[model samples]
Target: MALVAVVIPTYNESENIGGILNALSSLAGSAGLNIHVLVVDDNSVDGTVEIVEDFGRRTGFVSILRRPGKLGLGSAYVDGFRWCLRNLGDFAVAVEMDADGSHDPAQLPRLVEPILKGEVDVVIGSRYVKGGAWRGGRLSRRIISRGANLLVRLTVGLRVRDATSGYRAISKKVLEQAFSGERSYETGYIFQVETLYQYYLLGARILEVPISFYERAGGKSKLGPGELVSFAAWCFRQLAGRISGRVI
Candidate 1:
């Protein structure tokens, strides 16, 4: 059986964490994939860690690494991926997902199937594809998402339809190559443009599977207001540099 690990970052997500853990636990035995989770939580004040610990006790399919304080999402994934790669028995793939239940765990089998079949090195659960859509969120957020992705493709030249999608699966080879050591990627994306661009540079074969992005199950949005602004600024700078024959 192939082993798959899902890495999620959490902070004060007490109201929402259990739903995803439950879904993942139930899906563990199906599709011939040994699914496990590594939740890297930045010390949530709202009893989030207790809930995760309790769930792990009952199912053993879940494990958590609690940080001392609220570190960024980038660090959470780095630590979570490293922990799973070293501990999970013959880990074959690593998955990234949101803790707020916007991304579905039921679709995980399909997300990692191509990796298991040696078809693609990365699979992004995209909303820009033919069957995918985002159900709710501020109108500003929706527009920012679309614009950021358009800029990611226009500047970075990646062929992916959704460069900002948080739900995705990566083959063991790609993970080992791009994330073997400390990498200083920013947060806000949950795994955004920089991470995706690194994957592309590694020559990873990427694909997008359409997935409907629902509103969060609970808690406020973690994305800060400045994230999009910073991303847009960077994209334009990269575009300008590329145009000037001095790619940054």
Candidate 2:
């Protein structure tokens, strides 16, 4: 059985958490998977935690980690990864997915298959690959997403087509190495890029699979101007480090 732990970071996602969890629950009996849904919430006032609790009660496979206050996205994921590494014994794969419906739970198996077969240590659900397609969202948003990915590939030296994509699968071995030390990983939306780069630095075998990226089912995106600024600053910082012989 594939002992997979999915870590979903949520903040006021009451409108969509159920669907996300439900979709994941459906993956329970597939490929003899013993899947654990770890929903890490940042004290949402919108009853997001309540929904998670409800699901956890109904389906014994679900669990949650409640945070004190509104932490950044990067921190939420970092905390979740640490929790899984520390708690989930025999943890085989750790998945990074969005609470929004944009990331299809159906792709979970595809994302982790490479890891299971030892073809790769990390698997990324990509939108720029041959069979990948990104739908909805504003034209500007699409363009900006593409541009940001281009910048990360050039500056961070990560070869992923979708560096900003949240849908990913990482093996327990990779997770142990990623958090084995005190890493000052970014704690914002830029967390996606930083983690991807770290995996690359570790020389992990990485594979990209096609995914249909859709708009969210409900709720609004939490991205803001501050996140945009932080992302640019992070890219520049990494570029500067490379130029200064920081060796990634």
Give lDDT tens digits, candidate 1, residues 1-248: 88898998999899989998988887886556798889999999998899999999998888999999977777788888878878884889999998998998898888999999999999999999999989887788788788888888898777788988889999999988877767666655524777787888789999999998987888977778666577777777768977889843
Residue 57 of model 1, lDDT score? 96
Candidate 2 lDDT tens digits, 109-155: 89988898888999999999999998887788788889899989888
Clashing pairs in 1: none
Compared with the true structure, the alpha-carbon lDDT of candidate 2 equals: 0.89
lDDT for residue 58 in candidate 2, whole number 0-100: 88
Give the Cα-based TM-score of candidate 2 against the true structure: 0.97
Q: Indicate which candidate wins on lDDT.
A: 2
Q: Which ten residues in a row have the lowest lDDT in candidate 2?
A: 24-33
Badly placed stretches (over 4 Å) of model 2 are none
| Strongest candidate by TM-score | 2
Clashes of 1: 0
Q: What global local distance difference test value does model 1 have?
A: 0.84
Where does model 1 exceed 4 Å of error? 188-191, 244-248
Clashes of each: 0, 0
